[model samples]
Target: MRPKLLAAVLCLTLFGCASKQVVPTHNESRVQAEASLKAAESAGASRVPEAAQHMEFARQQIADAERLLVEGEQEAADMRFRQAEADADLALALARSIPLEREAQRATQQAEAARRSLQ
Candidate 1:
């Protein structure tokens, strides 16, 4: 019984140490989220309604992440930052794609008109 208890304590101690090691002391996720948000804004996410909504959500997530960090909730804060980054990235993509989609539609219309004229 004594040996079993000692082994269990040792295993728990090792597990605790390993878990602590896995958590990062610095919040790189926050930095990435901020960068992504900035990129999204630069891409003109506000002009597209969906992108704008995502950007706003990202901002809120970032704010929440900051608050979490203040409360010593590093893991939660990091997760929030990651979520914000994803939203911002999505916003950026939408902002870029909408214009391209419009252009593609216009080109397709022109092609159809040209074919009809040739006929």
Candidate 2:
């Protein structure tokens, strides 16, 4: 009886470890999206509109993922979550580039004016 009990305990422990290794895709996507959103927010405030939109979309995806996860459709949920994160990152990159682009344009204009004056 003691040996049987020990074997059961060992099996339970192994199962628990295995479960921990199986990270739900939705959770990973959610985390990545959140991180991207934070980066977008930090890059500049002018990107608020795009950032807000991305955040809203991400929230919706996360909600869907949660529902799917609850329904035991983990693989689908994970795919959606990854898509949400990609969308958020794209938005963030777009926002961060706006200011840089504007600066570049201004610099080019200034340089052109200087060249004209020199000529």
Candidate 3:
């Protein structure tokens, strides 16, 4: 009887360990997206408005994902997270365009010229 009890306890411990862990909060996903956006901007991205729009969209998706996760819809939440990630990637690509970069450079030069004139 003691051996049977030990076996049951061992089985329970193993099962507990094997269960999937809880998903992280939506804030974490937003933070990750924001970090990616900052990295892209630091790398000379110029389409700030477009990137901002995409970031907003990603934020919405993350909210949805979080809601689904809270409702125990793990698969749906995962899908939303994937979509949010894709949106962030799209924003990064748009921000990295050469035309936008050139526009940003021209704007920076103009601003510097204005500053110099004021000085």
Question: Which candidate's TM-score is highest?
Answer: 1
| Per-residue lDDT of candidate 1, residues 1-119 (tens digit) | 99999999999999998887455443688888889999999999999998999999999999999999899988888889989999999999999999899999999999999999999
Candidate 3 per-residue lDDT over residues 1-119, each given as its tens digit: 99999999999999998896977665566566566656655654444677767766777887898899889987777777777777777777877775567898999999999999999
Tell me the RMSD of model 2 versus the true structure: 5.3
Off by over 4 Å in 2: 1-25, 45-56
What's model 1's lDDT at 18? 82
Cα lDDT listed for each candidate: 0.91, 0.75, 0.75
Candidate number with the higher TM-score (1 or 2): 1
Provide the TM-score for each candidate, comma-separated: 0.73, 0.61, 0.49
Candidate 1 runs further than 4 Å off: 1-26
The per-residue C-alpha lDDT of model 3 at residue 19 equals: 100
* Per-prediction CA RMSD (Å): 5.0, 5.3, 8.9
Ordered list by TM-score, greatest first: 1, 2, 3
Model 2 Cα lDDT, one tens digit per residue, 3-93: 9999999999999998886565566677886787667667653355765677667668777877888999988888878877776676677
* Candidate 3, pairs of clashing residues: none
Best by lDDT: 1
- In model 3, state the lDDT of residue 92: 77
